[model samples]
Target: MRRTFCGSMIALAAMASPLSAESYPDVVSTSHYVPVRDGTRLAMSVYRPAVNTKAIEKPLPVIFVFTPYRGRSKDADGKVTETAMSDNLGLRSLLRAGYVVAVADIRGKGASFGHRRGFQDRTEALDGRDLVEWLAKQPYSDGSVGMVGCSYLGGAAFQVATTAPPSLKAAFIGASDLDKYAFVRNGGITAQFNTRPDEKPEVDLATVPMDEDRDGSMLKAAVAEHAENTPMGPLWYGMPYRDSMSAFTGTKFWEEVGPYTYLDTVKRAGIATYFWGNWRDEPTSQVILSAANLGSRFLAGPGSHCVPPEGFDLPGEIVHFFDHYLKHQDPDYGKLPRATYWVEGLNGTGGYVTSSELPGVRSHPLPWFLSQAGFGAQTSGAQGASTFTVDYDLPPAEYFAFWPRPMTEHGLGFAGGALQHDLKLVGYPVAQLKVSSDNPNADVFVYLDRIRADGTSEVISFGRLKLSHHKLSLAPYETLGLPWHSGFEKDVERPAAGEEVSLSIAMTPVSLVVPAGDRLRFVVAGADPRQRNLTDIKLDPAPRITVVWGGQDGSRVDLPLAN
Candidate 1:
């Protein structure tokens, strides 16, 4: 029998579900701790339609999500004294679509027991599997289960899906990193600047007291214990730990369960997966790697780390995907692969279009070699062009701020005001350069931007490469194909005084239609102050950069040609 439901009806149900008074869906509305391996009890919440006495009796497929946030209701004083389920828009959509939705607090947060651990940790996967197994046996569940979430939660979904429990069927992972080292550390270069190492562990934030005098000491002690233990130990310990005790027992968990270290093993598990990400999301590219490795479907859009209407039709698309895969109603589900990208315009007005694949267009290699007079192509061999000594002692370049700051007192201004350029690129662009540095190792920062006729320029995309780790391995390279996988791995050792070397740096994918008068510019530098300020790292003899051209050394840029 076919059942019909309206979006309006779902919205109304979400409002009255006791999850929230907000206009969006508020499906899940309470929390409880579910016990897992080693006596660890994890917190979880369930959101579904209010029982309709007149409704049909068939069971509904279940959608389970596990996040670090607290699942509890708050009082007028902004204090959370009672357990309440999450009320996210995505869950509401799932419930309205007639599915039972469940949200779990992975071990070590909210009402869940155990220590706080990060994504892809074995404990997380175990708890996830246990949760699905438990849910499948429940009367509310239709015996089928799927997982969904973004960022850390998305990563958790990826890990749990690989477990392939009998009841677990599919997953929707967005803005997640399959290769933890590359995505989080950027080739071992950590973003220690942005992340506060001392931040409190992931716990029931609502239950935390605002008055430090009351809760400060307990919070401090908890954080200190988490920091001291670190989650990586149990992960690498393997065997008894892997099969027995919970793997999540502390913070700094990423240090232990490196995603890249176990991707091959995980892929062999063969769980049906739906990988989603955004162009702007730093780690999103990793999803592509997962798709290619597991031969799963990949869906990408334009946005940052989080999914939304703020992004492309992520919530709706996820619902449809889960419906088809988990519910098994649509045989032709998610069979299409469209690379939908947004193009930024000169006037700040842009739209999105879908292409068959990345690097939609093919273009001839355009060589822009480095010379004493800036960048140019080589006409002949070693003798034809001027050879300047490469050193890192060049004047320090300031970071490029994407948005204007309240104080103009900072940052380096672009030459000739903002060099505005409009670009109508259709494919991938690669930058190849040749040169030997006095130092064997150095990081290259490649920035792509659109400059307007007026003095304003916005960075379109960028890519980085660590020179020494250039020996590409097929297995590791496959991981790099993922959107979230940043290829930079290890620092290149300092080069012999005059030995020359060639390097290939990948540029970020960009699809845009610039106004006729705008300009597309590429800036090659050592550090990007806007995104990352390397003011702290001291360089010896400062690395010198030399752009190699086809005729000069074997340097060239490969652009994906338009179909």
Candidate 2:
């Protein structure tokens, strides 16, 4: 018989049964360590509803989550309690949804044995397979298993599934760390939050927290210390790549940290996947949707990285995928879109729309030449003041904050307006320009904004580049509708002084509506001071950057308008 869902995920969040331990009379919560091939045992917590008898009436599917933080920390009362979920995104709703659930601490973290490696080290997939196999052998499990999580947990999910674990059936990944090297390290400037290397676990897992009482204090102290060391708010952005790599990379090699580095390999894993996350999320959900055409579904949210489970219908979606893949139910995958994204701003904005691909986007690239009279998106005219040399006063960090909707609005750089018409844009916008620097090396930040006649401004899109690494990869530009930087290594081309260099910088992908009567604006800043500690880096040539157009040198921005 097909199982009937209790209610919508919205109702599930409001339900009291899973919220309190008193209501979960038949649910069993157990904690233990799961062994891996390396003799490392990961601390694991399992929650399953019990049948009257020792064995369940029928085998059940399992949902496993891998977390970096210690979920269960002992309190002063000596009671082992789940702190992560209970305090963060609780798994109670999943337990109430009638599924066996398991949460494990990645090896070398949270009372688990061994040294914690870099994020999502490829080897964790092996342990993931072992965990899935272990779950399959459990009394209540029927062999089918799925994975789930957001952010770091999502990365773990992606890492394990890419390993092609035998018993793994599906995954629900939210705000996963994919394609971040492009967005995170945009234009050679460090973007978004990077990891804190100094915040290593104070309590050594090698010691093995033997006594629950003693270890609880040690674990609590370690967690507290780690939390203190980790920066909060909008603290990290716009440093050199070396600092980012150094902090994000731990004791292990850097290659293992970014799963996107092996983009092709991960996409080939063949697991039924649901890629869902907020569009405004630092890494951007669009990256996952557009990069691979796999057997997957995309559910994009309009919020930021910290979108709550209920806000994004997280519980409902997870149940839907797990129900179909793990429980063998026929959930309708046909009605799903190649991409379903949300658009904010302007008339009747802020609701999801389905699409064959990125919604309201096409190959209609319209050029807007830079002119003194504003942007000629419809007509081209040379700006009498077209050539503006690098002011050098612009900060490098302001170029990197490309999130929280409408992109980052730091007000750094040059300004121009596309007047008299509303520009509805979706997808990546390309900025091409002929630039020359007084110094041998220069960094440029280009930003686009929406200026309603009232004078209020909101950033629409932005792009950046280091003049040295200006070689564009035509392959990605052809397919993805934006330029792919060849990186600062092999593609380094430092322009000779006063010798103009052509550059095409790709902005972070976006979906927005510029309402009628609003105008489009563009800005160019030599460097953005808004980035974290970019002033420390000895930027070359002292910023005398020049943007020239029309007279011998042409510069323009191609806005991808929804046609």
For each candidate, the alpha-carbon lDDT, in order, equals 0.52, 0.59
Encode model 1's per-residue lDDT on 1-563: one tens digit a residue.
11223334443212222222222222334344567767766656665544332232357788888776554434558664322222233566566566777777656554455675544577778788899998898777889988888776777787777566788878877767765555444533443222322234544443342222263454344333444334442332221211123344543344345455555545565456766666565655566666655666666555655645343555566666776777665565545554455654414676665555533334334444433333333332342222333223334333322221211112111121222333355434566656555555665555555566774766665666555544443444453332222232233344565566655655655555656555545555554443332454536556665544335354444443332
Q: What's the TM for model 2?
A: 0.79
Q: What is the lDDT of residue 436 in candidate 1?
A: 52
Clashes of each: 46, 16
lDDT minimum window of 10 residues, candidate 1: 405-414
- Hey, what RMSD does candidate 2 come out at? 6.4
Measured with C-alpha atoms, the lDDT of residue 522 in candidate 1 is: 51
Using lDDT, give the best candidate's number.
Answer: 2
* Residue-level error in angstroms, candidate 2, position 294: 2.8
- Candidate 2: worst-modelled 10 consecutive residues by lDDT: 1-10
Q: How well is each residue in 1-563 modelled by candidate 2, as lDDT tens digits?
A: 11112222122343322222322224455566667887766777776744331223456778888877665555545565553234133355555556777888776567665554444665566777788889878877888888887777877888787677778888877776554445455666653445333334443322224233344554444333333332321122322331233343342233345454455654565577777666565455334533343445776667667475333455555665676677666556556666676766536555666777654346477787776555665454543333344443443443334352232243223345445555667766788887777776677778777777687876656667888767776442223545677453556677888887888887755677776666776777665554454555536546566677654346778777785
For every candidate structure, what is the RMSD over all alpha carbons to the true structure, in angstroms?
8.0, 6.4
